[model samples]
Target: MIETTPGIIISFVLYLIFMLLIGWIFYRRTQNLSDYILGGRGLNTWVTSMSAQASDMSGWLLLGLPGYAYIAGLESIWIAVGLAVGTYFNWRFIAQRLRKYTQIAGNSLTLPDYFENRFRANSKILRIVSALFILIFFLIYTASGFVAGAKLFNTVFGLSYIGALSIGVLVIIAYTFLGGFMAVSWTDFFQGMLMFIAILVVPLIAIGTMGGIDSTAASINAKNSELLNALTQIDGTTISAISIISL
Candidate 1:
């Protein structure tokens, strides 16, 4: 396949310009931390649901999920099932409660403030611990997203991996710092759609390219009988049974 280098570069520049435009719009509306962090906390259900789900899933839903399914066979479906179940529980139980609690806590604003007010006590330790947890987990989560972007850049454009990683981090931080929730939610809305299309399209293309499922299976088995069988070994131990356990 011939690489349309100029076309690719043009498309990338246009996409970046679109992102910057969105950030600029949000920045104009942003008057304080509230507008930046929570979009003034008046997000409607559709935006809230889409943004929350998009941010929560991040690159995992788009790249990792399909890759897992491809590598692990039908068993990987449990991961999707688990995510659906968790999402249902969150929407059904946690979402409303959190929304109410956040407001009732005198517009608590930050998470720690909400938590402290919920139990009606100024628990210094709990507040500190929660803040630390947020800092650590968010750092790791952001880092992971940067790593994914870097890998994509390396694979697509032949960029140095470290430079790609640094660029990824800077871009995310710039938009996020500039517009915060408005930037995140709006960007996620767009990114989530692209991700949905990508994950759906890639597997369909792969399947079509392989002729058909039955033929693909036959070809695989012909290459190696083991391809038709379950993976029996894991760290030199037989995987007798695998189950999902939630804590």
Candidate 2:
């Protein structure tokens, strides 16, 4: 049976309460559409960077990436490399230009709005198509996050699936319904810091507990030496470097 201690329950409850408090606090300050949409465009460099990174990573960084790495071994490193390169170019080249263009294009609030304004398009078709695609993809993305959260809660607390799912949805809705963009951004910043710490600390602890890198590598190789190979055949066909990057 999975153990769910009282201390863990208490700590989780307190964390939820704190998050709700943050939502309430920001809700009071959210007075207009601008505040609701983009935090009135007043975010500092640190908050903007961390929040963007946090929102981008979300549960995928915690769950999906690790699962992929576990299954694919060193080949999974290509995903990290591709993401790092893409992110760097996005921030370095596109972000500032897009921000400035959006502001200049009648102070557009959303992607569809920006697209309409940027191209000086008068047709409603572009906006309709864009909105439809966004809605479809965002629903898929949001559902994945909810599923990840439910799995996490169920594993940690041994809660029923539906019960854990409800809690996950409630926490998300609470903050989003209460405070909108500012609350999301602030919470994202905090979550990002927590994620960074976890990424560093957990691996260090695991490495130490396993006696070190050499021992860990030896054990992995003992099980299957193919896992140690960066490029290897799967089911008779060689896995291409390009395919790994694409994955």
lDDT of 2 by residue, 30-125 (tens): 989989898888889999999999888889999999887777677667778888999999999999999899899889989899989999898988
Supply the TM-score for candidate 2. Answer: 0.95
Backbone clashes (count) for model 1: 0
Give TM-scores for every candidate, taking all chains together and pairing residue i with residue i.
0.86, 0.95
Report the lDDT of model 1 for residue 226: 48
* Model 1: pairs clashing at backbone N, Cα or C within 3 Å: none
Q: What is the clash count of model 2?
A: 0
Model 1 spans > 4 angstroms off: 1-4, 220-242, 245-247
Report how far off residue 33 is in candidate 2 (Å).
0.6
Per-residue CA lDDT of candidate 1, range 96-141, in tens? 8888889898777778888787777755876788889999999899
Regions more than 4 Å wrong, model 2:
233-237
